[model samples]
Target: MPTVSMLDHLVLTVADLQATIRFYEDILGMRAVSFEPADGSTRWALSFGAQKINLHPADGPFDPKAALPAPGSADLCFLSDRDLDEWRQHLQAHEIRIEEGPVRRTGATGPILSLYLRDPDGNLIEVSNALHS
Candidate 1:
């Protein structure tokens, strides 16, 4: 049997693509980039670390997409090199509200300290840093 390794990217269907880009860039420090598909249309994506998030308009004609794509429906977690305190301050400085945390939780590797917030689309977002043993 074969195993899947890691995520390369995911598509997010968005109500407002620019707003989604702004939230990810201003708050999370990700980069927004444009790509020209084989169809010759320019498409947008957000890139960070080893992953990318491709953005699709909520109103369709976009193909080979999620069966039921909708905004405000994703719950995403991102790893941080910065500590929770720094994330707390950064989010505060951006005037983004924390829904919960600095709460301890299980991470893929070990224990993690997480801070929860919502993006412009109301998708739940968790920013977390691993706690060493």
Candidate 2:
């Protein structure tokens, strides 16, 4: 049996593609790498270093409140540890909400600081840096 190695990407359907792209780019610092146009609409891809996040416009009328992910549920975590204070300032400057302990030490591994936040789509994302091996 082949074992699962790692996540490839995440696809989120949003009401506004541009707004979502902006959130990822401006707030998360991901780069808007590419987009595909089909039938007058488009699908876009954003990159955080090597990770890819794909965005597609919602197909029809939908309720955002009903579609949001449950609290405490996360779709992904983008690990980083470089200059966490700067990251916090960046989020605060943009009025983006953040969870507690962007500064906690990991119990399972060496010291690491983590910051958690949600995307426009309510997907949980984490940034952390490993302090040791």
Among these predictions, the greatest TM-score belongs to: 1
Model 2, runs deviating above 4 Å: 37-42, 60-74, 103-111
Q: Model 2 over residues 6-112: C-alpha lDDT tens digits?
A: 77876666667778788888987788876554545444788876678666556542233236524223456566646788888888999988875666656345677
TM-score of each: 0.94, 0.70
Q: Tell me which residue pairs clash in candidate 1.
A: none
Error of 2 at 60 (Å): 5.5
How do the residues 1-133 of candidate 1 rate in per-residue lDDT, one tens digit apiece? 9999987898888999999999999999999999998989899999998799999989762798877889998999899999889989999999999999989989888898899999988999999998888
User: Candidate 2, 18: how far from true, in Å?
Assistant: 1.3
Weakest lDDT window of 10 consecutive positions for candidate 1: 59-68
How much is 26 displaced in model 1, in angstroms? 0.4
